[model samples]
Target: MPNSNPAHTSKYEESGVSQTGAETALGHLLKHVLPTRQFNTQFPVKADIGYFANVIDLGNGQGVALCTDGVGTKMRVAELLNQYDTIGIDCVAMNVNDLICIGARPISMVDYIACSHIEAHVFDQLGQGLAEGARQAGISISGGEISQIGEIITGIDLIGAALGHIHLDRINTGQHIQPGNLILGLAASGVHSNGLTLARRVLLGETPEMQQERVHQYESALDRTLGAELLEPTRIYVQPVLEMFEAGIDLKALVHITGGGLLNLLRVQTQNIRFVIDPVPDVPPVFSLIQQRGDITDAEMYEVFNMGVGFCIVVEHANDAEAVQKICKQHSISCHGIGYVETTDAGHNEVVVPSKNLIGSGSRFSAA
Candidate 1:
């Protein structure tokens, strides 16, 4: 368990971004109106408005899943350190991870890079990381666009959109998730590309010491420079999840713990099921250091960053969890049995963090 909360401040809110505000802003945007048919096929599009990725049915038990995501504020850390290699991996991981949440096997990806000016060597280095990521994810970089939008952008912004295939019958829609399902957690590779905005504000905020310091000057509890620790690329979980799928294991739901932190778990859940997460396991040392340095409350930390758990798997039974853990270990990623699912009030979707008064509502955190 983590240390008890004392007086703590919210880093994300102070940084001029609000989770609630982002959600509200999205509400007014034009709804995605899908045409009834494309090419006169009998199969229609599966309206995947809330899940991790949108599934487009192509009939005959075949479907395509597509998702797009960026590396978020993690780019700032990379810029500060002058390292551009692993950020590309973060970009691919963000998209492929989301695609697999709906049981899609990522087939290929295309990247979009926008910047005022990018060095030739920098692009080459980024390509190296992207290739490595595609290999790890078993995908290909088919095509992309790189635009030099002078003056309009000051920093490099990289985004990737990935497409995958899945059998609709094999999709883990969470509609079948019921009481007594085991919740399995896959350990993160450090913070894994989210919440760097709050982290940067906490560590390098307007201090003379920071101005004089280099990324290597700060040593992390994980026995690495803070820059290297923060630069650790996001882990790719596609292989293991797909392996389980191949082995005939039924994945009830997949949560690629990202921007909303543990709250990402709620995207698949409905009002009838309450996901009761256990008190987090011994958090990674990197996260502990962040919490202490930022004076961030446990609830806020869990809400903003992954707090050490990168991916979550909801299985039909405890035996299924053990099997999944075994598969994760074989793939060389750390794994843990984190929590379970249970019955809840109708249309009352909630994720209860055991032993804490923190529960995730639809759009924000609320007192349990």
Candidate 2:
């Protein structure tokens, strides 16, 4: 028989931490940790696909790039709300947003949808959302696949892959991220499609009617239910970022803050560098309500939610920072100089939280 007391479990004996605490720490590690890649390995296939985009050297200054990602467990909230339309847009935005992070111009996209059963209405709404997303990203949906796997899929799963083009020398892979660089933040379009699993588990515990009532209290103009707010399509950054690159700005690195929240920025830099963010904007009301209702820790809230800023660019000191702001304004997108890069000790990459109680507790990136 299994031990009823969790303290007797092997996990507790080995780690000396409580079972509940160990479980939480393990979950956090799995979500936040990134594995290191070795450079001395011989390979039959040679391609680096770690950054926002992967570029292949085909000689002659021409190259093909690709980026792929999914909307993640945000689909679960959409399922609970019976809203599947806008998720397709989230799928596209997640990939294209990353593509632009490496200065790639998104040219085409392909979607993969797996479902438990075939429902024409579901596909219709999903298709409309996907088409609209592709249009917004300035990319064509050449083709995609829909798998009806009843036994494997409990709800619909939407994922996408994007193909793009970039010049050989134009990729922003953080190779030029020097000390004293400026970090520019691009505002998110509400939630922007991440951390929904935790959000739903913690925030949306009420029934559909209860959720409607709660959401209406926050936003008087919101006629749709709470699920609708959760399903807001992710903002596509392809056009604006690409425009910045074409304008001859010396961009050093770009970070797309997705599944891992602000921590995603650490993926682009390795040396002892810190981001000093000042005047962190007020989080969305929905997020505020979630934090208040759940009484969630401030660290957990920033770790799991975008909390306003979504995408960021590390620009060289010599770059035209004003051009970035002007272009973003011309496109009607909000842009701000949120922070600056600072040198640190070896093997330390940190994000300085502006708030003392919340994420401002000095969170360090775990070993990748």
* After superposition, candidate 2 runs with Cα above 4 Å error: 1-49, 206-224, 357-368
Estimate TM-scores for all models.
Answer: 0.92, 0.81
- Colliding pairs, model 2: 34-368, 35-368, 36-368
Q: What is the lDDT of residue 156 in candidate 2?
A: 86
Per-residue lDDT tens digits of candidate 2, residues 66-143? 778888767866666566778888989998998887767889999999889888888898898899899888999999
Strongest candidate by lDDT:
1
Residue range with the least summed lDDT across 10 consecutive positions in model 1? 30-39
User: All candidates: CA RMSD in angstroms?
Assistant: 2.8, 7.3
Backbone clash total, candidate 1: 1
Off by over 4 Å in 1: 1-9, 30-43, 206-214
